[model samples]
Structures are given as C-alpha cells and as structure tokens.
Target: MSAQLIYDLVPLGSTLVYTDGSPRPPERHRKKLAVWETRNSGGRLIRKQAEARVGNTVLPASITLHKGDYGNQGTIVLRVHQTFSVNSDLKFAVKERPAIGSVLVLARPGDDAELVHLAANRADAEEWLTRHGYPRAVFREITADTVAADAVEGRAAA
Candidate 1:
C-alpha cells in the first residue's frame, strides 16, 4: 500500500510531539540547519536549506492520529500548521518481509549475542557473518503468507 507523504517544514520555534504523546522541549543542540546543493547534467545548480531537530528522542512534525489497525477509533486530527500534501508513492518495506523464496537470516556476535545485521538470503547472510566475525546466524524461509502474518501480528502488538 502507498501513503501520501505530507509534512510541513518545521518552523524555527515550533515544538514537536513524541510517539508516546509527550512534548519535547526545544534546545540549542536539538535544532539543526542543513544546506544541500546539487548540479544537474544541464549545468543547472540548485541549493536548499532545511531545519531539523536532533536529540536522544525527537518527535514527529506530523502524525496520523487515532487510526487503529482494526478500525477507526476516533476522528482524524488535522492541525493547521500540519495541513499540507505531497503527491508521491510511499512503500512500507518491513525488514521481516523478504523477497519470495528468499531466506531471512540474523547475524549475531559470538560473545554478546547482539543482532548485527539482517540479510535477505543465506549467501549474503553467511558473507556478513564471516565479515563481522559472528559465530553463527539464524535463517528462516520466506513463505507466501509469512510476511503478511508477521505484519498483522506486529500491528496487533503495537
């Protein structure tokens, strides 16, 4: 499924909200200004600057409120500053969903057992495991309905 990627250029003094419904106070280090420049093949140059917030925990500028996985729980909240639209194709690529007939593998450290990487196939996973010096890796086959079931379970848990 595709979704409309709508957002506003967060203003200088606006505060953002966290996913847990808490407000994040603006701070000096949390604010950042970035400048991007690009040159096209036709010799046209373009420059743009954008402001963003950075910290341990940062809130989203906009959100789709009250839309439950099972059904609609309440009315959607469309704030004035958040009301904007962009026409684009959005694909939600979940990591657990590998290509059909491929294998999903998790590379973990030998000493710490921490997940280092998730590879789509056994060959790539083995390569990563060897490169990272991981002792072992876990592999699972991707069936037709495996990804769909996992997605549904994830939504329900959330």
Candidate 2:
C-alpha cells in the first residue's frame, strides 16, 4: 500500500532575441529556473515544494533551458520530477470472490476511491479487502484476462 510517484515536465520561459535590431518585445529576465513536486491525497493534489530547482552548473542541483532565438522565436524546456506516497491499508469485511493478478480499488463513503493494491491470488485479495475495512461490494477487481485485453487495446491505440 505504498504511494505512487508521478513525473511531469513543464515549460517556464524561453530566452529571447530580436531581429532587425528592434526591441519591440520587452525582454523578460529571470534569475533562476525551478520545478515543484506535490502529493495527491483524497483526490486532491497539493504543492509540496516552493523552489525545486535553481541555476547550478557544478553541483548539478538545478536545471537550465537552452534555446536559440531564430526569427524572433525562442523555445525552452523545463523538466519537473514529482513523487507521491499514499497509505492504502484499510480494515473491512469481504463479501466478494477474489481472483489472481487482479487490480483492486477501495471505495470510501463520500470520498473518491483509490487503487489500494494488486491481488496475486484470491486469498490475498480477500485478505486485503477484509483487513482494509473495505466491503467486497465496494471493491472492484479487474481480472488478469481483462488487463491483458486492455494492454492489447492500448498498444493498438498507441
């Protein structure tokens, strides 16, 4: 029941240049570049870091975007890395049958349900549901066959 980690890359700004010796577009100067990380709890994602990166060349602590301004065009790419952890253990009673290699989701009463764990076997799934206080009726299981079919579909779509 550990949390999941998510990574995202964002674009902050770009280095600009002027053509025909014109400064019509005011130059926007920035000191340092940064990235932030957040956690998702109860369907709410919160920002946990204010300044994740700064300009650093030797220590390799910050990230820099380098792009050339050609024809009054400038482009820069910023990479943002994030990690999140969620506790997925709950205690409840089991009322449904379990299957191997099935994905299980725990549904809470007024809150969004979350993926708690993957079941290796019927016993394991049943035990997890019973211990996590999740009723079998509130739990949804995606069987291994279905997962394989979904993977095939995903590959085709891609």
Which candidate has the top score in lDDT?
A: 1
TM-score of 1: 0.32
What would the TM-scores of all predictions be?
0.32, 0.28
Tens-place lDDT per residue, model 2, 34-121, is 1110111122121212223356623212222122223334332442332232222211111122343453444443233333444565
TM-score of model number 2: 0.28
Q: What are the candidates' C-alpha RMSDs?
A: 19.6, 21.2
Model 2 alpha-carbon miss at residue 54, Å: 40
Residue 144 C-alpha lDDT in model 1: 63
Question: Candidate 1: where are CA atoms >4 Å away?
Answer: 1-18, 29-103, 107-114, 151-158
Q: Give the per-residue lDDT of model 1 (tens digit) for 19-78.
A: 222344444434321111110001100111222357865433322211112324654344
Model 1: ten consecutive residues of lowest lDDT: 36-45
* Candidate 2, residue 102: lDDT: 51
